[model samples]
Structures are given as structure tokens and as C-alpha cells.
Target: MVSAVITAAGLNRRMREDLLSKGMTIEHKLIMDLKGKPVIIRTIENVLESGVKNCVVVLGHYSEEINSVLKDFPDERVKIIYNHDLDCELSETLLNGVKNIEYGLCLCVAADQPTVTYNTMAKLIENAINYENPENIVSILARKETGFLESAEGLGMPFVCHSKLLLNYLPEHKDNLNPILREMISNDVVFYGTPAINELELVNINRYNDYLYIKNKF
Candidate 1:
């Protein structure tokens, strides 16, 4: 069974500022409407549908508001965790979620990816489970600028690998997750990229413009 760590904890300064300028009063981007559902909820649903056994959602910055919206979420497979440090970096927030994983294979998801399809997630999970080597990481590369499957920074999020692999390195890691994965690659942890159903499936919401773009696309 694959467990998932959904990182929703971050200071939404850019999105907040962008919404405020338009006189909108959203507490966090995760709770924003994506089609007919909240962005985070849609993300969680897709993860569950993809065959993940369980998932931990790590929340920060508008934790209360995000929690309130997700309080009655119907799936028992989803768990919510809190990172009290509002200014914590992305790696720190992911660390909190990674610690709660109960399965050997862990899937790291960004909560802002509301449009990510279950097919894309399922393909990655299938690859991870069927992989010959336990040490290799399976990931999806969505960013075009990065260009290569293996870059200096290594593969980014929406990746699946052993929880021990992340727990072994993440505690002492800092900043974005890609660098740590890069370090792991240098230490013999090979990463394989799973093709995404669509590049738009991995687009994350950072600002109001992103939200608008996705909403339109959806």
C-alpha cells in the first residue's frame, strides 16, 4: 500500500495579496473553489482514487480555515496534521507529513494541484510498486523549464519512493525538496520519471492568475 503526504502548509503571501487586491476574502488557496469543489479536497479525492491506502495533509498559515473546510471530508483514509510554524520552509512542512507515513512507498503531493488526474497518480504508484529496485524513486516532471528528467536539482514533487528514503535525508534537509532528492541521486538513488497524463495535471496554484487559469481550464 502506498501512503501519501500532501503538503498544504505554506504562507500564501502571493495568493493572499493577489486576492486582497481583487477584494476577495479567501483565507488560503487550498480552500479556494476549483470547479465545484475546494482545491485541496479535489487533490485529496484524486489521491484516494489513485489507490493510495492513506494520506496525511499537513496544514499551516491559515490552518484553522483549511481544517474547517476539510473537517467533514468523507474519507477515513485522509489524515490532517499541523505545522504551527507559519514561516516554516517547504521541506520542513513535508518533513512533518513524511513522519506520519505508515507505508513503505510514499507519494508526495502538492495540495494546490487540484486538477491532477487519478490516472497520472496511479501510473506513478504502479511504476513504484512494480519497480525492480527498492532504492529507485519514481517521479513526474511537469516543469518545462527544467527540461530534463534528471536535473542538477533532481526530480521534484508528485514523486513516489520509500518513506525511509525521505526520513533518512529530510530531517537534515532544507529549502525545496528537489535539492535533497538531488543529493540522494548523487548517493546512488536513481530517479525515473513517469509521464504525466497532461502537463496541466501538475500545475500548482501560486497566485490569483494561476487560480484563474486553472479554473478556466477545468
Candidate 2:
């Protein structure tokens, strides 16, 4: 059985600022509308449809809002963890999720990536499960510059890795884990890259402009 973790624990400072200007103190970007449903809801729904046996969502910045939105998912299939340190970097959020993963291969995906399809997730899980070398890390590569996609932007360096390897290497550099992960890839860490499904899948909403762009696209 493959496990998946969705990291939703960032301050989303820019989004919060945008909301504050409109007289809102609590605006959860993850729960913001995308198309018709909430962005994070769409993300979690895709994970459930992808055949993953277990799913863990790590919440931080807007925990109450996010948790309230996800209250309908069954506790048995979806679990939530709160990260009090919202200021901590991505590495810390990843580490928190890794500690809860119970499967051999855990996929750490970002909740902001609402465009990620179930088929894309299935492909990643299949590669991780069937890969001959346990040390190999399976990842996805984006093709174009999607406005909201973070990994596909120039020099953004998008890729995914096995939870075991990520957990092992993340602690060495608490501030940033990508550099260390890339180093591992250079040292013969078998990596399987999939063609970008669409530039939209890589979009990560970081600012008000990004949110507007995605809203307009939808």
C-alpha cells in the first residue's frame, strides 16, 4: 500500500495580506475557491481517487480553517497533523509528515497543487512500488511555465522523492531540502521523471496575483 502526505502548513503571508486589505483576518488560501470547490478539497479528492491507501494532511498557518473544511473526510482514511511552527521551512513540514507515514513509499505532495490529476499520482505510486532499486527516488518534471506552478518556473527545479530518503536527508539542512535532494540525485539515486501533464499542475499560489491568475483561468 502506498501512503501520501499533503503539506499545507505555510503562512501564505501574501495571501493573508490580500485578505486583510479586504477586512478579513482569517483567510485560508488552501480553502479558497478554485473552479467551484475549494482548492485543497480538490487536491485531497484527487488523492482519494488515486488509490492511495492512506493520506495524511499536515496543517499549520490556517489550521482551524483547513481542518473545518476537511472535517467530512473519514478519519480512518485521512489523518491530520498540526504544525505549530508555521514559520519553519518546508523541510520541517515534510519531516512532520514523514513521521506519520506507515507505508514503504510515501508521496509528499503540496496541497496548493490543485491541478494535479489522479492519473499523475497513480503513475508516481506505480513507479515507486515497482522500482527494483529501493534507493531510487521517483519524481515528476514539469514542462512549461504555468503562472501558479512553483516547480516549473525558471530554475525552480521541480521533483518528488521517496519519504525514506527525504526524511533521512532533510534534517541535515533544516532551511532548504531541495539542494540536498538534488545532490542525492546526482550521486546515482535512480530517478524516474514523468512528462509534465500540464503547466497548471505545477502552479503554486504564493501571492495575490497568482490567485487572481488561477481564478481567471478557472
Candidate 3:
């Protein structure tokens, strides 16, 4: 069965500071009423609706606050894993989630990306399962041309290997996987990338302005 690993451990430092200066707290950001429901709650709901039977959420910085927001959700389907080292980088969070998963393939998504639709996720899973090489590391979305035009160009791929590929590389390059993964692709490691139905679903909320933009749009 397919599973999903969501990384939500970041400090949300910028957004937290922005709210605090306005006489608010991090809890406001966690359970903030956006489009009538909490932001992360909506994120989790979307994942559940996406057909994934099991989901593991890796929590850090605001673990307590995030958990409080999701307390009403059923424990059977969604499991919350805490990353005690809140100061660690995103790579650690990704690794923590992978270690707990027994599924052959797992989708790693950023928790702050609440706009991801069930359709987009289904497409990713479909491609991964039906593609010529199901074992190849498959990314759900690709960076759009508009994103490049807007000067947001980088390695536009999403997704990474959960087993053979990532596990083999981590021992030598334990710090970051991006460069190593890229090099592996160059050296002919099986990799797959699919276009997203809506590019906005890939937008990750990092700063206060980003949160505001998403709120205004959706």
C-alpha cells in the first residue's frame, strides 16, 4: 500500500514573529481560521482525501500546537511523529519520516503546502505505479515555466527515493540529498518527474508574505 510522509517541523520563524509583533502567538498560526478552518487541518484533510491509507506527519518547532489542532482526527489513519531536534534542518525531518515507514513507496510532502489537491496527489501515485520503472524515484510536480520567468528557478523536481537510492547515498553524503540526488540522475539513476495540474499546489509557505498571498488567493 502507498503511504505519505509530511514534513512539518520547521520553526515557522518568520510567520511566528510576524504574528507575535501584532500581539498574537504561534498557536494562532497553527489553528488560524483560514477559509473557515485551520490551515494545517485543511492540509491534513486534503491528504486524507487523496486516497493515501496511511500518513505520518513529522512535527518539530510547534509540535504541541500542531498536534492540538489535529487532536480531533482519528489516530488509526494519521500518525504524528515528533522530531525532538527542532533546530535540525529539513533533511533530518525527511529521514525521520522515512525510518518509520514500511511502504514500498512513500510520498514526501511539505506540510506548509496546504493547497495541494487530491487530484494532483492521485496523478502522482498513478504515474509512479503505472510508469515503466515503478522503482524510479518519482516526483509529483515540476516547476512551471512561469515560475522560471518569475526568477524562482532551481532544481524544479519534487519527490525523492525512500529506500535503495536515498539509503545508499546517505552514508557518504549525510548532510544534504539534493546535490547527491542530482548527481545520481546525471549518472543515470532512474528518476521521474510529472507536471502538476495546478502549479500553485507546489507553493510552500515560508514567509509571512507567502502566507498572506495564499490566504488572499485561496
For every candidate, C-alpha RMSD to the true structure in Å: 2.2, 4.2, 3.9
State how far residue 127 of model 2 sits from its true place (Å). Answer: 2.4
Task: Show model 1 residue runs off by greater than 4 Å.
Answer: 142-148, 152-155
Model 1's TM-score against the true structure: 0.91
Tens digits of per-residue lDDT for model 2 on 1-218? 67788888887788888877877665678888888888888888888777778888999877887888888875578899987677788878877887888746776678887777788777766766767765466454435442223242232223445666866777777665556656665666766666557666667777666777777875
lDDT of 1 by residue, 1-218 (tens): 78999999888889989988989875688888887889999999989998989999999888888998899999899899998687888889988998888848988889998777888888778777777875466455445433225553535778788888888888897789777877886777756666666757767899899898899988
Error of 3 at 188 (Å): 2.2
Those runs of model 2 whose alpha carbons end farther than 4 Å from true positions after fitting are 19-26, 143-160
Model 2 lDDT on a 0 to 1 scale: 0.71
Q: Which candidate tops TM-score?
A: 1
Of candidate 3, the 10-residue stretch with the lowest lDDT total is 144-153
Estimate the TM-score of every prediction: 0.91, 0.83, 0.82
Model 2: colliding residue pairs: 148-203, 148-204, 149-202, 149-203
lDDT (Cα, 0-100) at 98 in candidate 3: 71
Name the candidate, 1 or 2, with the larger lDDT value. Answer: 1
What TM-score would candidate 2 get against the native?
0.83
